[model samples]
Target: MDRTTDIIIIKSIDQLPSVDEIKSISRERALKLVFKENINRQREEIGQYLDDTLSGFLVLIHKIDPELNIVKLITDKEIEDHQNFFEQCAKDYRQLGQKLVFMLVDKLDLNLNKDFPLDTFNELKRDERQIGKVAEWKYFVHGFHCGFQNIITGQYIEVPLVFGLEFGDLDPYFFVKFILSSPDYHPLPIPLFEEYADGLRIIEKMVSLGKFEKIHSKIGGHDGTVVTDREKVEIKSNLDLEKIFVNHIKEIEKKSKFNLWKFLGLKK
Candidate 1:
C-alpha cells in the first residue's frame, strides 16, 4: 500500500530506475511541432495521432501503485494502452492542462440541486485534482487548456525529467478534445462523421465484449497519507476536493453530444 509513482528525467538512459518500469514519454525540446497558436485553430487538429520521436530527455509518470512502488493493479498491457491514450492526447510537448476522461452511462440524476452552486462551481474551476489511472473504463477525455507558457506539467511533484538539451516550440494553446475525427460541438462532414461513427461502433462492440481491462488504485487521505477508505472523502489540499463530483461518479448520457445532463453511472 506504500507504492509511489514518480517521473525522473535523465540526460541518458543510465538514469533509468531499477524499479519495475512503468512507462516514460521523452521528446527532444528542439523537435518542431505544428499546432494552432490559439484555441480556435487547435480544434481543427483533432483526431490526429502522435507518431513523433522525441529528442530531448523528458518523462511522464502517471499514478500507479505496487506494494513497493505504488503501481496500479492493472497489467502491463493495460498500462501501455493507457499510456498510448495519454501520449495521443498529450501530443504536444507542452504540458499545461487539467482534465477528466469520464465513462458514459445511462440516465441517472446528478442528485444535486440543479441551481448548481454557481459559487461552488466557480471555486471548482480553480481546482487541480486529476482522476488517476482511470482508463479501461468507457470514457471520454475532458480536456482543459493544458501546456502553459510557464509551469511544467509535473514540476511541482518533482517529476524526474532530465533535459540535456534546450526546450523548443510547442503548440501554444493545445486542447485535448479530439474523438477520432468525430464531430465535436461542430459536426464533421458526412464522410468523416461516418468514418468516426464506424470506428466508434467497432469500439462499442469491443468494449461490450470486455476487450479492454479495468484498473484500480488507492486514494490517499487528506494529509497526503495513503488511505483505504473509498467514500465520504474530503481533501483540503491544493486540489480543493471539498466535495467530490459524486462518489464513484459516472457520466449519464442523454444529449447528442456528451453533456452534464447525460453522464456516466456505474453499471449495476
Candidate 2:
C-alpha cells in the first residue's frame, strides 16, 4: 500500500550513525539496519504515542542531495497557506456534519526506474491463455509491487496523509484521500503538492528538535479513548485532531515564529 505518513525519527542525533558513515554502507542494507534499530528503539522507548515506519529513505535523500535543505524550503507564506487549507478542510467537514483531519506522514519515494521491476514484469507477459499462469507467477514473485507515482500531480512526489473521520477508528495503518475527479469534491484552494512539501519540512523540524514528547504532551491531556468497530483504540487526537494540530502549529509559530532555519541553527 502507498503509505500516507512520513517516518519521523524521534531518537536523539547521538543515537544515529553519522550520515557520512551511513552513506558508506549499501543503501538497502543501511535502510534495513535503520528499520531494525528504529523499530526496536521506538517500541522500547515511546511506543505508547509515537508510532513510525522505521526506515531511512529520508536519510538517503539527504545523502543523495547534500544541499537538499528541506528546512530551507519551509517559508512563512507557505505555513499560512497550509494553515488556511487546514481551516478550510475543517470548515467544510463541519458543514457536512462530520469531522476530518489531515496528518503529515512519512512517504517513501522509490525510483521506479531502479527499484521497480517494470522491465522484468513486461518480459514475463504472456498470451491470453497463459495470462492467469503469468499473473500467478508474477504474484508469487513480485506480490503487491506497484509504482510510486502521485495519481493527481503525476510526480514522483510521495507523501502520506492521515485521516480518521470523527466517528471512526484511527490506526497507524489507515488513510483516506479524496480525488478531484470524484464527484463529491471541489478544486482545492491551494496546490496540494507544494503544501504537502512545506508541511513535511515543519513536521521534520518538530521531530528533529526532539519535541516529540512535548508535542504529544500538549495534546495528551485531552481524551483519546474511543470505541471502534472491533474494539477500543486510542488515537492521540485531542477530541478534534484538526483543532489540536492547528493549536500546535500556533504554538510552534509563537515559539519559533515559523523561522525554522534559525530555530534549527541552520541560520547565522
Q: Which sections of candidate 2 miss by over 4 Å?
A: 1-74, 93-188, 194-197, 200-268
**131-222, model 2: which lDDT tens digit per residue?**
22111121111211111233444222111112122222111111112222223334544333223343444334333433211112113242
Error (Å) of candidate 1 at residue 72 is 39
Q: Which model scores highest in lDDT?
A: 2
RMSD of each: 23.5, 25.1
Question: After TM-score superposition, what is the CA distance of residue 197 in candidate 2 from its true location, in Å?
Answer: 4.8
Residue 78, model 2: Cα distance from true site in angstroms = 3.1
| TM-scores, each model vs. reference | 0.16, 0.22
Which TM-score value belongs to model 1?
0.16
Off by over 4 Å in 1: 1-177, 180-192, 208-268
Model 1, span 71-159: residue lDDT tens:
22222333245443323322222221111201110111113221222222233234442222222222211221111121222211111
Candidate 2, residue 24: Cα displacement in angstroms equals 31
